[model samples]
Target: MKFTRRASANWKGTGMEGTGTVSTQSTVLNQTQYSFKTRFADGVGTNPEELIGAAHAGCFTMQFSFLLNEAGFTADNIDTEAKVNFEDGSIVSINLDLTATIPNISDEQFQTIAAAAKEKCPISRLFKTEITLTAKLA
Candidate 1:
């Protein structure tokens, strides 16, 4: 199956002095500039790349929880953080750190399930960059 999202951007002037528009609509748009990405904290909003990282992290954590449940284990908490590294304007890697509280599971079993989740998550398969996962069981 295939899925796609439509996005468009329009930039005016130079990279430092210019601003842009991002839209799903044909005409009306949202404004953006270099400050939108670098100088500003993204709590207001962000571009697709940042949004993708957020989606990947959250989706993977939820997927891991489901996998654990299928193995007869339940998790108290699963916190995942994903770091996206850009080198020379290219996406270099995505690092995922997952902290989970799983009651009554052996360390070995936890490792096995964690590995399964990392490899089996759909988002992991969608990316070409390196994906690193650190799973801590507490």
Candidate 2:
């Protein structure tokens, strides 16, 4: 399937002093505030890295669920944290920490499925940086 999504940003003034607002087509983030301080320093609001991490975490977790179902297992709980490591104005790597509770699944099976899901997830595939994952089954 082919589809599209949209988000917009507006900024005023210089890069270091300017502030911007980002909004999604769905209005979930209706002109959410973002500023230089928010991105590079401590400030209230959101940053691009956190947004990307959240998106990656959400996408990978959902893809994992789909894989578990296909493998004849269902997860009772799945939690994932995507850590984006940035350096020298680039995202160097992403680490996905995942914990899942599934019924009647072997450790080997879980590991295999998690690895496959990590590779198959759309967000994971989008990144050229190294992606590492640590998955635990509980």
Model 2's alpha-carbon lDDT is 0.96
lDDT of 1: 0.76
N/CA/C clash count, model 1? 0
- Candidate 1 lDDT, 62-128, residue by residue in tens: 8899889999999988899988877776778989888889999998898888888878888888999
Q: 18-117, model 2: which lDDT tens digit per residue?
A: 9999999999999999999999889998989999999999999999999999989999999999999989999999999999999899999999999999
- Give each model a TM-score: 0.73, 0.97
RMSD of 2: 0.8
The clash count for each model shown is 0, 0
Error of 1 at 13 (Å): 5.8
RMSD per model, one decimal:
4.3, 0.8
